[model samples]
Target: KVALQFEEDWKERVYDRRYVALAHGELPKSQGTVSSYLKDDSHYVTHSSQEDNGGKFAVTHYKKLKSGNGYSLVELQLETGRKNQIRVHLQDLGCPVVGDLKYGDGSDPIGRLGLHAYKLCFKHPVTGEDLKFTSDIPKAFSAVVEAI
Candidate 1:
């Protein structure tokens, strides 16, 4: 039997500032890391902009990889995985993922969530060996990125 462990590498997301502007949300003027605290109450996970809040500590780092007309292709790394961590953090950044109805402005430019896990790495549970897996970006995602 194989016991898989989660070791986050990075995720590809499309951040669209247009949505934030349309929704009257504040947009982050800078990009680097987000160390916001989060709390999961089953129904929803909320975040406190403060660092010392009594919520579960979550950290996500992001950088702009490419720019589009009104959006950008971003690479994100999660230091601490939590429920809806990426989505929540993106929302906090005011550049929610395109096609993310729950977090963004209900846009579906790709007809699916604009989030993809392209790589995963883990250690073998029994042999303690390192293993890694990778996959190509979906055609739909690629097309959208290309068009944007």
Candidate 2:
């Protein structure tokens, strides 16, 4: 996954995290590696923030949810330009993009990730209409909203 940290230049860093099921109790003694530590592993999977954290999922735009379920903000301009980049990234972090059981949270109540691309504000590519649109948080996100 590709993520940019908060610092000078804001150079983006990319990691290739994948699903590796541990054999029985083989989970890492440390929840994650030091590299992931610098990237905030524990909460990275959740829809929260990466304000000084270090872990695998470093790209911050739509962070893990930190509190009562409500909505999530997503900026797709940085999409890795790959199929399932977002879903793969979030799943790698352990927090499958909510309703996307194929990625992170498989225990979906309604269906789909508890996340959404709630806002889309930009100027028309040609018309320059300063178009802006927003979508309500998916109801699936609400059923487990309080979990976060």
TM-score for each predicted model, relative to the true structure = 0.73, 0.44
- Residue-level lDDT of model 1, residues 7-44, one tens digit each, is 23222121211111111122354357877778755667
| Cα lDDT over the full model 1 | 0.59
Q: lDDT per model, in order?
A: 0.59, 0.36
RMSD of each: 7.2, 12.8
Name the best candidate (by TM-score). 1
Q: Which pairs, if any, clash in model 1?
A: none
Question: Candidate 2 residues 1-148, lDDT tens each?
Answer: 1122223222232122222121111111223321111222344433323344432333322322222343232222332223344555444444444456444545555554444455554444334455556665554444444444
Q: Give candidate 2 regions above 4 Å deviation.
A: 1-60, 68-80, 113-115
